[model samples]
Target chain A: MKPACKSCTKEHEKTNYLHMKQQIIEILTELRPEFDFTQDVDFIEAGMLDSFDVIMLVNTLDEKLGISIDGMDVVPENFSSAEKIEALLKKNGVK
Target chain B: MSLKFTYHNKRICGILTVLPQREVLFEEEMDNYNFSPAKSMKLKLAMGFNKHRIVDENTNVSDLAVFGINYLLNNQLIKKEDISALILVTQSPEHFLPATSNIIQGKADLGTDMLCMDINQGCGGFVIGLMQAYSLLEQQEIKKVLLINADVLSHKVSKRDRNSYPLVGDAACLTVVERSETPETIHAVVNMDGRGASAIQIPAGGFKMPGTPETAEVKEDENGNFRSLENLVMKGDEVFNFVQTKVPPMIEELLKIAGKTTDEIDYYFFHQPNKFMLNKLADKIGVPREKMPSNVVENFGNASGATIPTAVSFNLGDVALTHSYEVCFSGFGIGLTWAAIVQKLEKLKFNEIIYY
Candidate 1:
């Protein structure tokens, strides 16, 4: 069984997605170790994250940290930067 | 009573067409570029449409439609025969009244014995037009239907609408639908939400929101222009959610109905909007990297209804139609609409089929 979502523990609006950047970085590095997430460049625009990689990213977010990601949540604003992804997860109540 | 149904009968018989931003030919200075600051920074959160050409200040919606019709009629040996019907789908029309279809019918010389009309559908207009053509062909009496889709959203798009600047590029697209010797049945389903209608919509210029001095003059942004984002404000996040929520599932249901899976599909041609949105949809559906079609946004901008066929035509060589076995086409956005259909491409090259 999947663990309870950490995001569900807090208000959807008040959660801090920015705080999860490091964790996201670490997970991404593990998934695609060659990915140098340290760049200020946008992962998607830079051609690093294609559709295949994005699903892996979303799938991991759902598995490790416990967040409910919806389809609309995948836009560039949310997933382009690590900070944005963190914020989206927090919005979903990711602790 | 039940009839034995078939999913593979109708094939994408002839050829598909795609026009880049060069076609619309915008005359306004505001139509020059996607001024969004995020684009340079790579934060292209919204779709970025560089410069679009709808009709150089000289031409209008009608002119663009006729261009496509001439191409279609000239190619086939239909013998100046009366078309069974003509459907023009557009958000941009010349006058406030008569259908754009009339102009196309007049230009194509398709006889009056045909049914001619316009459908005011948004982005999904092209696909819907194809379905209508499908219906007419099913009757057996109608043999060919010409579907023309054109839009000059720049008319409504304010110059300074930074967010929507990249969101819209003016253009027109036309597809000649015919009863295939092996016609593509175009089994399809269209979904929409009037509530979400306001998500990506214009506030004036139509029946519901007539244009007024106040509505027209208001500067939506610091740039003092109005386009899709300003005149037609899109709750970017919300609209994204709407498509994300609706499109993937719809594609799944479509594939299920067709009794096929991702592995069986040769290609999934989507309306090129943005890399982010395309990647998101492709990810959600588990579509393989190779099976996915071209994302023409980097070049054509978003030609509204034209993107699907454009992608089909753009990636023709990559998929190697014969080897892939089948290709699927889908379109989303605008009308808050979404649709998908499966097709098998005949082994004819575009040059061989269209003779272009």
Candidate 2:
């Protein structure tokens, strides 16, 4: 087995990040279909998401993407929107 | 910390619960929480909460417990003299001075010779009360222990607070535990993390933070729930995370100590916070929906200390009285406490839910 070159590994990581964002959007939409995930960036402030919804989203991400979310990381901003959740995953080294 | 042990002689002989006559539907309270019709439906679907039974303002914890205990005595399921020890577990008691157990014992005329005490506990009250009762029974002199778990939390929460109001219902349960000639195996595991104490608590109205005129002034939270500092506040996300991550492993540890598997257990009665949370926990723990019930929250709301017994009464009340079962009970929340107990019940008389 040969190790992947640094450039190739970086390219794969970038692709993985994009895939995680798309998957996160899908999860949010499925969990609460009434809300438009693309337009609703301020989920908490807009009342589009409640505590129960956040928990479902957390479990879904862990189940679908294998992203282990610590209880401390379940803040308002991290779960505020699809883009924020994607960034949170990247910050936690999801890939 | 985690404590694991067994009770050899004590066995639950009978169980009874009392609920208030009043019922509150979610749709009626939509305006209180500023919830739209779609949002209300979403909450109902996700949380399995549509209606809750709450006691009126005048009713207190002692009222419900006494009513249930009187029913048990009147039906001849238990005699007043046969009760060797009385333990009342609740966060809401009749008075802060005299132990509520003493008051109940006095009201029931059980005599002062019987041991009576009160414990401050919340959602995990049933298992903890059972443990306490079994400990008293282990002393050998106590032949029968009456463990009363009650919480009239409806009085403590603000009706305007959707997070707390729709989730809490007032109720009380009296479980008669007696000494068995043949030792029955009962396994209990209690785990506590004080760091999460503030997750679900009343910030004021306690010895540490006594209530004042200022505390009585109602204020609206960011979520639109009107409450005072003395009222109950719950950080839902913290609690959900705690249960999802901590409870399943604790239950597995309980099964391991009992030298049994989930397959052997006949029923799993967990503290019913809501449908979504319970279903998620059932999936994480690998217990089927049939085995673990999620309707107590919908039917009775989260009655804190009384939740597990209420769950038992709602699901298995009729059949449990006539049949034998290998039962597992788990409760978590408030004190950031979580506990599980696995035991066997043989033809215990389970009475119907009384409306007081």
Candidate 3:
């Protein structure tokens, strides 16, 4: 059911980190149109985003991507942009 | 002024580092963590979080600090031996006795002789760390300061703690502040509440409550239970009321002190707390969305004290720091604390003069 990592035993993580980031941004944009979708917009002011969105995002990344994100790593700085979020996944060797 | 003499200077820097973070256990193709009913209804409703980062049990924050500081230093040609002061701020230290900064210095491959210490401020830690560096630099004792805001919120975090699960996010931030006569300087207004200190505090493992059966078994109200004891708890309405009433006035006072107006400042970075609060504050204070810098709440979930500097580092690339333009900042939360700092960003070339 999961593509386990030979070293860390993490699952098919990267495949989903990429897919969900776009999907979530699309979801967020549809929910709130005023946000500058071209770049990373502040969650609260953008209307559809908030703190819980990150949790949901982590869950989304996990369920869709299969990488178990460490709680300590789930910070705002990492998630500010699709680029940063994707970069974080790559830096961790998660994807 | 008798004579202008420059002494060995102390400055502060910041770095934000994070490790691999994902849920510990989850197996799903398209399932969403947001739909889980176990999470706090308010947390889910107010900001809409479902899954937050889960740092591994073995991973302490000092490692993250090392990663962050190394990354920041990799770009600049600076050696570790140049550092004079290092302040590590974290709620979770590597050990009960040894300061966490010592471990960070050891791992980051630094030379000996650093004034390393640990700070115990809950979330206002990063700002306090900045203030500490500022004081030292002003005294011209140390040459540089590393203000590391790193924390691992997993070991103490309860999976069953719905209230805190969505709210408390983790991260490591490092900032490098060097001595500058005409560089960006911070002017801050800081406040703390020791009376309401017990409002958000650890209930176990300390001299006051000493992790023993007789002392530990005392008062199982809403802490450390299977039902709702694991997560951080806050009287939201009380905290909200306090911030709304106090923060705006504080900003007004800070503006007066700096002799500037909302219109005069180039960039204003609020804590970027939540959508609801941001909306209210923006309306009340007249801080246009353009002036505010944030990648706020719903994005990274709340990185606690790391929010302010995180906003700056993430967004400042686009900001052209001109001599005429100045930056204004504010940080608030936990320990029921908040701070406002205003300063001018000076030119980077001020140090380059051909001396005879």
Candidate 4:
């Protein structure tokens, strides 16, 4: 198999990031179907996510994404929004 | 670091969980929380907080244990004379000096030939207590071990503390562990991290921080939950993370060591912190939701170390009385300690949940 060129690698990375972002949104929506996670709002501050929800989110992310999230990264901040959760997944070495 | 052990010819012959008669519904206490109705309801649904059994304010750990043991004795489920050792595991001992086990021994009037000792442990205490029972049975003179796990921790949790109050429950489980002539291999594993001790603890009332008036001063945490130093404080997120990150691997390791696959085990009677956590843990470990019943918390609250036995007696009481199953009992929390036991439970002489 030939290694990807620089432009090809960049394109692949962009696609992966977009796919990861979509997955995060779907997870957040599934967790609390009533909440609109697409909006750029703080889930924690808006009472959309509590500590228990954060733990559930982490568990789902770990299972769905096939990534082991660091316990230290399970704080409310990391799960306050889909964008933040996506960043957390990326930090955990997700594609 | 995991402490692994395998014991032979030991079995848990009986289990009786005594729950208080009083039941407090989560909706009744919803007004006590600092959150809105909708938010609190979400928490209630997520955490499986329906109702929990709590002892009267005047009750203590020894009281519950005495009641449970007396029930066992009166019903002839356990013979008092056969009990060679009395082991009481709890974080809510009646007195610091006399040892609650001795107090129970004296109150129950079990003969003086038995060894009475107390172990301070929380959720993981049941498995730890079983470990101790197995060790004691190793002695030639010892025959039956009366392992009582009781905690009236509801007394220690502030009613206003939304984080710990609604979930804390009081219950006692008296299990009779005895030597079995039938050959059996009981595999167990225990792992602890003291650094996470504060993850689930009552910060004061020990010698390190004696009970002072100031320690009893109720204060609000950042999350708006009210608690004092003397009350039980649980850092929920940290404990959840601990369970999620550590427990599945521990179970896998134990199954591996025991040369058994996940499907080989009949049931996973783990400590019921909450339904959500237990369900997540079951998912993580590939155990079916039905196999790992997480209804204990919703029904009787999280009874600390007693949860495992409570789970068994509550869910499998009728069937377990005459049937046999290869079960895995795991408990985690309060010492930041996690432990598991894999053994065959067969035809228990007594397996039921009685109300105090």
What C-alpha RMSD separates each model from the true structure? 8.9, 4.5, 17.4, 4.2
Query: What is candidate 3's lDDT per residue for A8-88, written digit by digit as tens?
Result: 333345556557567757754543455655565655454434445555565555446555554445555666666766676
Worst 10 residues of 1 chain A by lDDT: A10-19
Q: Candidate 3: lDDT of B58?
A: 70
What C-alpha lDDT, on a 0 to 100 scale, does residue B278 get in candidate 1? 70
The DockQ value obtained for model 3 is 0.03
Candidate 4 lDDT tens digits, B67-178: 9888988988888889999999988888778888998999998999999999999999999999999999999999799999999999999998888888889999999999
Better of 1 and 2 by DockQ: 1
lDDT over C-alpha atoms for residue A39 of model 3: 67
**Interface RMSD, every prediction, one decimal place:** 7.8, 4.8, 13.2, 4.4
Ranking by lDDT: 4, 2, 1, 3
A1-63 per-residue lDDT for model 1 (tens digits): 443676664544244443466788887676556679978878877766644356557666766
By the DockQ metric, which is better: model 3 or model 4?
4
Clashing pairs in 4: none
- Model 2 steric clash pairs: none
Tens-place lDDT per residue, model 4, A16-89, is 77888888888778777888888878999998877866866776777777766765566788887777888888
Q: How accurate is candidate 4 locally (lDDT)?
A: 0.88
| Model 3 regions more than 4 Å off | A1-95, B1-45, B48-51, B183-185, B211-231, B318-325, B345-356
Ranking of predictions according to DockQ:
4, 1, 2, 3
| Model 2 spans > 4 angstroms off | A1-36, A39-48, A55-95
State each candidate's chain A TM-score: 0.72, 0.77, 0.55, 0.85
| Candidate 2 per-residue lDDT over residues B296-337, each given as its tens digit | 988888899899988888888788878888989998999999
Per candidate, the number of residue pairs that clash is 21, 0, 39, 0
lDDT of candidate model 2 versus the reference: 0.84
